[model samples]
Structure formats: C-alpha cells, structure tokens
Target: MSPFKGKTGFKRILNAGGYSLDGLRAAFTGEAAFRQLVLLNVILIPLSFFLNVSRVERALLIAVCLLALIVELLNSAIEAVVDRISLDLHPLSKNAKDMGSAAQFVVLTMIAVVWALILL
Candidate 1:
C-alpha cells in the first residue's frame, strides 16, 4: 500500500485541490484543444453577463459554455491516457480519440445554438 493512499480529511482535500490545479496547468500547457476551449470560455462566459438575457437564459448560456470546458478537459485526459498506453497505430485508440473530438464538437455546437436562440 502507498502512504499517499492513506490520506483523509482536510489534508486529502487539500492534496486533491492541488492535484486539480496541476491538471489544469498541464492541460493549458500541453493541449492546444484545451487552450482553445479555454479561450472560447474566456470570451463567451463574460459575454453571457453582458447579453440582454433573462436570468435563466444567462445561466443556461454560462452552463453550456462551462460544459464545453468540462468536455474538453475530459477529452484531453482521454487522449493523454490513450497516448500513454501506446503511440502505436491502433483502431481502438483512434476510436477513443475520435469520440473525444466528437464530444467537444457537439458541445461547441450546443453553445452556438443556445446563444443564437437566446440572442436572436
């Protein structure tokens, strides 16, 4: 057993927060897709605040934007894990990567559709 696994209580929570920060740093630095999504969020999230939308519309707009970021994070993680397993050309690896890309695409489309419906 590892000593790291035995952590609990506040210490565990603190370590987990640190780990999450590290993951974000890694994603921002290493993944161009993640950075691009982050850039999109930077633009859209604040734009949501400025829009003449109802509270619910604003919230939905922000929610979908955040969802895109979440999906991108998951996608980046999946690609990293797949690459770590093997860089060799494999069908399953390609499928996994493609699926992640597809998920991001869907989220981005959702953001556009939601904003369009609310604004126009």
Candidate 2:
C-alpha cells in the first residue's frame, strides 16, 4: 500500500493546522534552538512595543521574527533528514548540518542588526 493512501486521522489533524502550524509544532517539539528563539521573541516583542518604535521599525522587527523562525525550521529539517539517513558522523553530513546552522546564525545576526538599527 502507498503511504499517501486515503485520509488518516492524524493526517486530518495535520491538515487542520496547515504548513505554518506544522512548522510551529516541529519547532516546539524537536528543535531546542527554536524553543530558545521563541523565548527570546517573547521578551523582544513586548520590549519592541514599549520602545515607541516607528511603524517601519515595527514591521522590520516582525520580519526578523518570521525570518528567524523560518530559517531555524529549515535548519531543523536539514538536521532531521541528515540524521535519518545516517546516525554516523560523516563529514559531508556534518558539513550539511553546519551549513544549515550557519544559515540560521546569519538570519539571527540580521535580526539583531535590524532591531538595533531601528531601535537604537
């Protein structure tokens, strides 16, 4: 039987939330980095609101949060796929995970820089 066979009950739950919802659950479940990033966002959001930022600045801040989450989710996916392929520490697999991590770091740096530029 094909994996994509008729609607399973779990599939229905997944369908209800959509892609972003899946991303969110994945973030909270398997990704520790995402959990920390979310905690940071929690702190940052209220601070952003209280700081009297301009509308553009607020928009940029929102953009940064979304970017951070998206990048982290992609990184998590890469790591998951790599691990699923082989649990051994192959150099190429290490490189793939490292590159994904670096991409997340770059996104985080962008978020920080944009927030600083807007607020300070």
Candidate 3:
C-alpha cells in the first residue's frame, strides 16, 4: 500500500484541511499562472453576484471560475510530482506536464463559454 494513505475521522479531516491549505499556499507562491488566475477570481467572483442573472446562473458562473482554479491546482500538483521524480528532460515527464497543462486550458475555455453564455 502507499505510505500516504491511512487517516480516518476528525483527526484525518483536520490533517487533510491543513494539507490542502499548504497546497494552496505552495501553488500561490510557486506558480505565476495560479496567482494570475486567483487575481482574476478575486475580481470575477464578486462581480458574478452583481450581474443580472438567475441564482442558478450565478452559481454556474462562479462554479466554472472556481473549476479553472481547481484544474490549475491539479496541474501544479502534477508538475510538482513530475519534477520531484526527476528534473531531467525526459519525454514521459514532458508528456505528463503537457497533459496537465492541456487539462487546465480546457477548463479555462469552459469558464469562458459559461461566462459568455450567462452574462452576454
């Protein structure tokens, strides 16, 4: 079994929360793309509320924006793990990182489509 796998209950929840916050802090500090998306979220999330849309539409807008952040975090995690394994310019490592980037790009495109449909 994996060494990182076995925590349960309230203690697990607390530990998980701490780990998640640390991941966010690491991503915010280490990834410029993450920082840019976060700044966009800071403006867009609140602006989403004030737009003349139904509650469901507002939620969809906000959710898609947040999804971009989620994808970015996952991408960052993938890159980090790949780098941790080796910094060498291996083809597989490059492919893994590229796939993560493509995932983020797709999510960003989805966010744009959702926002345009709801707001315009």
Measured by TM-score, the strongest candidate is 1
TM-score (C-alpha) between model 1 and the true structure: 0.94
Minimal lDDT window, size 10, model 3: 2-11
Q: Write the per-residue lDDT of candidate 2 for residues 1-120, one digit (tens) a residue.
A: 877556669886677669668778877987789999898889877777777878788877887887888888889999989999999989999999999999998998998899888867
- Give the runs in model 3 whose Cα sits over 4 Å from its true position: 2-6
Residue range with the least summed lDDT across 10 consecutive positions in model 2: 4-13
Sorted on TM-score, highest at the top, how do the candidates line up? 1, 3, 2
The root-mean-square deviation over C-alpha atoms between each candidate and the true structure, in angstroms, is 1.4, 3.5, 1.3
Q: Rank the candidates by lDDT, best first.
A: 3, 1, 2
Q: How does model 2 fare in lDDT?
A: 0.86
* Model 1, span 17-111: residue lDDT tens: 99999999998999888888888889989988898889999999999999988998999999989999999999999999999999999999999
Q: What's model 2's lDDT at 109?
A: 92
Give the count of colliding residue pairs in each prediction: 0, 0, 0
